[model samples]
Each structure stands twice: as C-alpha cells, then as structure tokens.
Target: MRRTDLSSGARTQPPSVDRAGSGKAGPALILGAALLGLGLGAYAIERIIPRRPMLRGRVIYRDGDYEIRDYPAFHALEMSLYGGREDALQRAFERVSGADRDGERPAALLDPVMQSRRSNAADGDDTGFTHGRWSVRVPLSAARAADCGFESVDPRLRVISVPAQRVAVLRFTSTEDVAFGINRVMLEDFVEDEGLEAEGPVFYAYYGLSRALPFGRQHEVLLPVSP
Candidate 1:
C-alpha cells in the first residue's frame, strides 16, 4: 500500500517490505525473529506494568449527540494518526499505554473521526477502507483538568457525559496499540451476552494513562445508548 509514516514528527515514507525476497534464510530469519521478539516484549511490558495518574478530566462540550472530554495530553495522542484509521488509533494507544500483557486490551480503542462517504458511487472508493473520518473537539474548560485533582478528584480518573443517556461499556487491558481488537472481542461478547442490537460504532474515551508510574496508559470503550 502507498502510505507514509506519520507516527512521530513529520510524515515520511517508510521502506516497503518485499514479501518475495524475504524467502532467503539467515538474516531474514534473524530479522523476523527480532520483530517477533519486539512485539512480544511490548506485550509483556504492558501485561505486567502497573498504573499511574496522568491527569483528571471532565466533559466540556456536547456535539448535538456526543460529549467531549478534555485532557492535557489529548492533542498529542489524537494527532498521531494522519487518518482516522482504527489501526492507527490502536498503535497510538499502545504507544501511550505503559502496561504489559496482564492488563491490556488490544482492541476497542478507536479514532473518533467522522466517516467520510463518496459523493458518487462511481468514485470507486467503495472498499470503505478509509470511509470514516477521525476527529476530536477540545472542551471549553479543558485546561481545568489539572485542577479537578486538587479538589479531591483523582488524577487517574475521568468522566464523560453526553446527556440524558447511559451506555453499556466493556473493559479490558492492553497498551493502546492493540486495544481496538480486544475491545472488538469484548464488545461482541457484550452484544451476544445482552442480546442488544448495535446501531453503529462504539463510543468511548481514554482516561488515565496508567495507575503505575511512567508507561501506564488507560482508556475505556463505550457504546452509544439507545432510547
């Protein structure tokens, strides 16, 4: 796929991975093993890690239907994804979450972008791969997140309200990167368990980074409430 790495600072093209030429042994095996180990290591770190207080927050705005919570680090995390792709959101979660295998949900974390649709069917973007748009709005009083903790509010805790509604939420553990998949599994389980029909994509928010020191990141997956 033609793409650029927009994870870090500026966007840059990444070297393509050639599948055919990778059949060679020696270095290929080593590289593959190295990558496997790296993935496993990340999983391990997230599983065993503890949590820590990152910030306290509350909902600041309601977008006709949805509420927005403002966190100090929200901008840094949201902007990491060039597009609102679920894969990108998962990676961002993993990067920010400081947990190990024991407490990480690899799915459920999602980019809150508006899904864009083709104006005409002939546009040929029918794959629906990039159909959704990712977006976030800062609350008017978002800067007060830090103050909430001083008034006895736990910095590690947060709340979001869309008004006049409640949602069924599913929880799990994972560094943000893979939270989406885990969330998906959990959501499916919830749906089957409760026999509730879904009207659309799930709703949610990223709460404290972690309960442990540096490296801990946490968030929640929320489903929209139906009347």
Candidate 2:
C-alpha cells in the first residue's frame, strides 16, 4: 500500500542547547580582563606621578631603614573607625575632605597619612573587625586662629595639634593593605637595640595611595621616644 509510514514521516528535531552558562561566562571573562587592565594602569600612574612634598622633618639619627626624626608641631585631622581598613580610610578621607557635608570647606590633602590601632580590650569583644584611627595633616591655613580647632564636616573628625617631638622610625615598602604589625616589631627591635625607649603606641605613616604599587608606596612605623 502507498500509505505514508507515520514513524518515517515524523520530523526529527535537534537537541536543545543551554547557552545561559556560556553567556554569563563570556561577560565575566571580559570584566575580569578590564579590571586587571585598570589595576595595571593605576600602578603605572602611581609609579610615574610626582609625590606631594612630605612635611619636612630633620633626621636626628639614621641606620639604614631605621631613623630618628625630629618633626615640628603640626595640625592634623583625625578620625576613628571600627571596621575594614579600606572602608575606614574612605570614610575618613571623605570626612576630612568635606565631601560628606554641604557648605563645608575641604581640608588640604597631604602626604603621609598616619594610622594607629585601637585596643580591643577596651571594647571587651574581639569581633575581628578592625578598630583604628586615621589622621592626615591639613594645611596650616585650615587651623583656627585661637586654637588648633580645624573645622570638619563630620563630627567624628577633630583637629589635634601635635607637639614637636623626636620619633623612632622604621621605613619599608610593601603592597599589603596593612604592614604595621611586622614593621612595628622591626622598629621595636631596632629601638631596643639602640637603647631607646618607646614613649607611645606605635603608629604608621604612609606616603602613597593605599592601592599604589609596592615600589611606589612608602610606609613607616613610628614610635615616639624620649629625646
């Protein structure tokens, strides 16, 4: 009989392919490449850029990376933050720069941002979140005539007058986010070896963006000492 066979006449269809996974993967790869390029470019810019002149201080003693410097009295904008170091730094920057409030005068940005760790014993609970203070020197013009009362847009920030003093400093360069611990230890060892006593908590001074390349960034662990 000439009757069409239903099975033979049935249309064959190709298997359906799921492209959702591959579609996402393509964009992710592109984004990753873009970010990598951006990071490299930033590192390059930092390397070639001329740094703002650091606040001048006389070197009292020098021993390789370790030194004793006599710094003059200066006014600084200081703030405390309790969380990630990056977040803390950003918030502190905004506060000091007057970007957080309207009609607030921005403080002059300066080299060598300073930082100090806050003791967790006072808080009574170690949540692993970072607790620290960040300080940046502002232009002398920003200081009030009466006192070191530098106006800040954020109440958390205040202007403090630092007295002229001699500090034991251990300088190093690194790419890590926080190099205070190891550098502090080294400074302490150097101070002890030199028969010097630490008069205050160890704080850090950074001369470059936190994200700058290791070679382009400079860090110092500073311990106030009896002069």
Candidate 3:
C-alpha cells in the first residue's frame, strides 16, 4: 500500500528488499524511508508552526451544499499526461515531490505544492481515455516555482499561472477506490444555488492520495468561480 504524508503530499510505499540479490532497496523504498524521516521531523516542528493546510484558502460563505472560498493567486506546475489518474499522480510524484534519497536528487521544497488533479472524462465516460487531454497539477509556491530544476523528469510537464479567484468547493468521501471524476450534479447545484458563475478545469484535492479506500477518505472538488 502507498501512503501519502498528510502534511506534505509526499508519496511513500513500504520498503521492500530487492529480489535480484542487489542488496539494495528500490526507489519506492528509499523514498519511503526518506519521507518517514521527514514526517517525524515535521511532526516535531508542527508544535511551533501552524498546522493547517499550507494551500488552504479563506472560506467566505457557506450555505451547506457548498462554500465560497477566496483564494489568492498561486503559481503551479501542471503536466498533462496520457494515462489514468493514478498514473498521472505517480508521474507527477516522481517528478515534483520533495524527497531526497539513495543517490537520487531531492526536489526543492520551500512550501510543498498540494497534489491536485482535473480529469477530462468527467461526464460519465466509460472509456478510460482516448487522447493526451488529461492533466495533473501541483500547486507550487513562488520559491518552489523559481527553484524548479525538474529538467530530468518527463518533458511534457510545464508551469502555468493561476489567477486569484474565488471558488465554490464541495467536500465528500467515496467508498470505491478506483472511481474518479467530479460529480456533475453537486457542481451544478452549487453553481445554481450560490448564483456563482464558474469557469473551466475543475479541481480535485485528495486529503491523501485518491487510491485509499473510499469510506471516510476525505477529498474535495473545487470549481473556479467568476471573480
């Protein structure tokens, strides 16, 4: 099983011994151990630092179905990939996550970007995917954006600017592990009831990675609102 750090969106899978007599752990194992070390360190520092979401925006209004949030403009590095959501996440993880281990270079981490995604096939499309139209985005701080040296990862990843905007957000948990995509009715309802206009590319922010079991696993969808 893969575990994502709650404080930082670092992916950690359990360490496993190499079966080929290499006497070395795999990248996943090394990454896991490194993150475990950092997680412990962060736990100690959490006592002195604010422990809320590093990317959390201000909640301005709420009527039950959804809440209006005021989000300041933030820079993000987005990568569109031709794969399932998990594949995109893993690709994004291997590329952008802040981890140092076993001769592998550590990614820069001033403030770790929140792991967020937007699937293009949200309209009940049973097909997995046809083209490279889906995208995965990691919201980055200005510092991280400036220090980004991710030249060795996939070539398709690129940075994009996200303007300051208000968003209507909905929180929910699911029981299915592999299912994804924004709930159309909830988004539409929020848009209609709140009288808020929305733009394109809705976002999904998983509390942990979306691969976790559905029950009590928290995640949210953010619809960009017209300012």
Candidate 4:
C-alpha cells in the first residue's frame, strides 16, 4: 500500500473544476459587451445625422450607364493639382480649406471628386511616365458664388463659372479608387447615336459616398459637349 503524501512536489488539476471555462467566461463577456456597445453607438450616430444630397444633373435621356443631359451652370472654387489621384485630392482640400477670405465651407465639391488629365504636347515625352493634371471644382450656389470671393493668393486656385451645357453622362457603381477604364465602345456609340460632339474633359461625379461599404457606391462620368 502506498501512503498519500500531502506535500507532494507534483501538481494535480482539480476534478471537474472547469478552470479554462471559468477563466475565459468573464473576459469573453466583457469583450463581447464592449464590442456590442461600440457597434450600437456607431449605428446610432449614423442614423442621427442627415446625409448630404449628392451631386446630380437632370436626366434628359436615360439608357443603361449612358445618358445625355443639360447640366446647369454653377460657380466653383477650383484648383489644379499634379500627381497621383489621392495626392491631388489631398492638396486641393488643403488649399481650399486654407482660404481665410470668405471663410468658405465647401459642399464637398462633387462626388468621386472631379479628376482630369492634361494633354501631352505633340513633341513632348512619349515616355512611359506622365504626371496627372488633376483639377478640383467645388461648385457653389449662385448666391454663395456671388457672395464668396477666393482671396487665396494662389493664382491657380480661383472661382469660375461652370457654364450650363450638355454632357454624355455615364453612370456605374464602383469604388472611387478604381482605374477609370471607361467603356469607350458604349460611349462612342452613344455619341454617334445622339449625333453629339465631345467638347471638353470628362467630369466624374459621385453619390452615396458616405456609406460605409465601398460596394454599390454610385459614380457618374460626365463628358462635356458643345451640343
């Protein structure tokens, strides 16, 4: 018979003690509750605030991803930025925000924010490298446009009128970061069918940008025109 020694060096786990379960139970519930509270708080805030009315133009004609419309003219404080897409937008935001003159508040300009590239010179570098000539146009109400003056010393940043004109509007749902590989065939077909001419650079408008999910975000590509 072996005698049971109380002062044995080896340790033994207690029977059915459930140490693992008991140890985890407290922290798991705490973490879960914390996460749940945060989610609820965010949802509440999202519901409480009113969303902005995204940019839109009257749809005179409509087809899938293509249409022709007469966009109303409006004034905007605009600036030309150079570099990658994100870089350009950041610079524009800073310049516009720094305006100490009218202490202007921007109407978020437009959705997806307008981005355009300048034409390379005929004799200029045909090299693979090309810099972006991105422009940001923040449209202003006629009353506000008249009242507000861009006093920024930056010559490139100035307020101007976007003359009311027609455009070939192409809409799609996409994240703003996607490369704008426009469906050239569809657009060209639209132009031919409508007997319209391409006049100026394309304007990209955005909607539903405030939503958290990137999927289903609305984007519109506006090609300027003479007709």
Candidate 5:
C-alpha cells in the first residue's frame, strides 16, 4: 500500500515481500506479522509524539466517523495551487514556518490543514478538478489580522477570515485518491439522508505530521451545511 507524507504531501510505497516459498502458511504468517507490527507502531507513535493542537470546534452530532460540528470563525493562511501539489505545499509550509521571513518568529503550527478543489467553469464533469487551494489555520484572531505580522509573498497567498460555520464531516484514514473519492460519496449520501442542505464544495482536512504511519494518520472530508 502507498501512504502520504503529510508534512511534505509526498506519496511513499511500502516495501513488498515475496511469499512464493513455504507454502500457504508463509502468506498467512506474513499478514499476521504485518498487522502486529502496525498495531505496535501506532501505539508507539501515539505515546511518543507530542501532537499539535487542532482547530477547535463543537460536535453537535456523531455517527461512527461522521459528525456535524460547529466551528467558530477563525483566521487561516491560504493559497491557490496552480502548479504542482507538492511544490505548493512546500511553499505554503515555508511561509507558515517563517522560513521566508528571516529573523521572524515562526507561526504556531496547527493540525488538519484544509484543501479543496478549484473547478474550471469550462469543465463539464463535476468531479473534474483543474487546480486546488490549501489553507492552514493559524493561531491568530480574525479581528486583528494586521497584528499577526504575516504577509503574503505570493500573489495567490492571502490571510482570510473563515466565518463561523456548521459543517458535516466524514473521518477516514489513508491518503489514497480512491479513499478520498469514496469518503466524499459516503459523506454526500449521509448529508442527503439527514436532509441537510450543503452550502459549499467538499474539502479535505489532513491532520498530524508525516511521522504518523498510514494506519495512524487522520483525514476528514467536510462540507459546510445550512444551519
């Protein structure tokens, strides 16, 4: 299976092993061992790594990995990705970390960076995406944006205030494109079943750093809903 490095937004494939020898017992044993290893690794990562604070929100409803959350208006650094996804992510990170601003204090990192597709009007297919947008919540008040001392170097980058919203979210693991597509379908179905009116396009929320293994990583599909 392939996994993403959340820090860099890079995909990595795990090493494959040959199971030709030792009969059917070999494959079963390998599977069991892999499961055990993953379990142990997840536990270790949880215990050893200090997690970053996630954007605060109140959960008003919950069903398995699905939830309706009420989030307060917050400030976020956002940029449109017209180029490669990886390159855009790296540039955003550099700006967030103050690597671009010499001698300045880096902004506090937050969990669950949000990304959404930017559809071209010419594209007939709703599922077709031309580019994307990436946004990361910053520890700053929307009321006092100027005090934050954050400035955008790229024309596409800007600091914006996201209004308070009621959102329906579907939580899942794995960074695979198929996983995202599947969850989006499930989330849309859930919204329809609940009779909720979707107010915006579907966006993805990615949590934690790349140090987290694929099994332990967290991803969410979120859609704004009418109150």
Candidate 6:
C-alpha cells in the first residue's frame, strides 16, 4: 500500500517570517523622524541664507524712465489694482508674511517701478503669464544719476537724477502658495543664465496686473546683476 506523504503535500514554507514581533513601528518611526529632521534642516538652511534688500537704481525703457520710489510706490501700485480707501496692500503683506505686523515680506520693500501690462504672448514671451499680474523692470546702478541703461541713452532720452542703489532682483508670477525652496532653485538657475550673481531678497518688478497673466504665461524672474 502506498502511504500518502502529507508532509510533502503540505504548503511549502514561506521564504521568511517576521516572528521577531519587532514590528515596523520602530524602524518606521525612526525613518519618519529622519525625514522630518531632514525637511526641517533644509528649511532652516533656506532661511539662514543671507538675504538683504538692495536698492535697484534707475530703470528706463524706450517708453519711459523710472526712479527709485519708496515703499509707498508699491502700496500705490497695489492699491490701484486692488481697491480704494482701505489698505488692502497692507493686508496682503500681512498674509504674505504670515504676520500682522509691518516690516514683514522683505521683498515688498523693493518698490514697484515701471508697471507694464502685457497681453498673452505665446512662445518664449509668455506675457500675461501669471494672470493679469504685473511684471516689473527696475534699473540698477551705483547711483541714480549714474548710467543705468545698457549703454549711452539715445538723443530722445533724458537722464534724471533719482535715488540710486544696488539690488538683487527677481521676476516671478503670483501664486496662492509661495514655495521658497523652488524659488531658490529657480533663482540659482536664473543667476547662472543671466551671468549675474545671486544677491537676493528676491524682488519682483511687476509689469502689468496679476489677473491678466495666466499660469506659465507670465514672464518674471529674479535679476542678479552686479552690484
């Protein structure tokens, strides 16, 4: 009589079993802590980087020229597009800083100069890129009276003495969420692309209005020119 070999037919042993009961809790906790620490460290590094607000000298174009205006300039521009009577710009500033105090949002201190609103331009232009948001073009120099343009201005131009200064500028579209980390990366790229140095508080020279420019359609980046 052939005896049935039940042992042979029994299920093959699994390759491995977690009998230690050590469970994933310890390792998972450790991993999660590590990740948390890593993220915090990265954020700390980002904040620790030195960022100062430098003055961007005179800015001019074929259309017109602009001198350095005070923070009031920014407030004015913001108010124009936002509303009247109330200080909505100040409110926006508070929101941006996650604070209810002044002197927050360092980038706001840079001031707005030439506000040029561009219609949607396709391809590289990417105008009206970030809704109808404005794109700024500020000039930089040793002094306001100093030469700010590419070179000598044409006969049709006039050089006016404005508040001259140095600055680290950036051009970015508006966002419901501002990601400093990504901004830092893009800032590095922009500096390299422009052959300029990164001396940044990250200023935006808003050209037009925000509602006009759509996503990836607006054109703005930090300008890291020589001091």
Winner on lDDT between 4 and 6 is 4
Writing each residue's lDDT as its tens digit, candidate 3 over 46-98 gives 55443223466899888665778888887676666565555665666556552
lDDT of 6 by residue, 1-227 (tens): 13355778854554554446568679989999999997777566546643323433344221112121222111211212232101333333333223212242223222233333333333463322334332223322233224233223223223333322343334445542244235545655655664656443344343322222222322233433454
Q: Any runs in candidate 1 off by more than 4 Å, and if so which?
A: 1-132, 137-161, 209-214
What overall lDDT, based on C-alpha atoms, would model 5 receive against the true structure? Answer: 0.69
lDDT (0 to 1) per candidate:
0.41, 0.65, 0.58, 0.62, 0.69, 0.36
| Whole-structure CA lDDT of model 2 | 0.65
* Best candidate according to TM-score: 5
Enumerate residue pairs that collide in model 4.
111-206
Leading candidate by lDDT: 5
Clashing pairs in 5: none
Looking at model 3, the pairs that clash are 174-214
TM-score of each: 0.33, 0.64, 0.58, 0.63, 0.66, 0.26
Cα-based lDDT at residue 20, candidate 2: 48
Residue 163 CA displacement from its true place in model 5, Å: 0.7
Model 1 per-residue lDDT tens digits across residues 15-127? 56755565577797999999999777766766675322233435554433233343333321122233434554444445333221223332212223212122222345443
| Top-down lDDT ranking | 5, 2, 4, 3, 1, 6
lDDT of 3: 0.58
Worst 10 residues of 6 by lDDT: 70-79
How well does candidate 3 match the true structure in TM-score terms?
A: 0.58
Writing each residue's lDDT as its tens digit, candidate 2 over 115-144 gives: 666644236434322554434433233333
Q: Write the per-residue lDDT of candidate 5 for residues 1-227, one digit (tens) a residue.
A: 34567886676667556545548887889999999998998889877876766787899999999999999887776666543333445466555645234445433446667766663423353443323443433434333345554453455557787899999999988666667778999999999999999999887787765355555668889999999
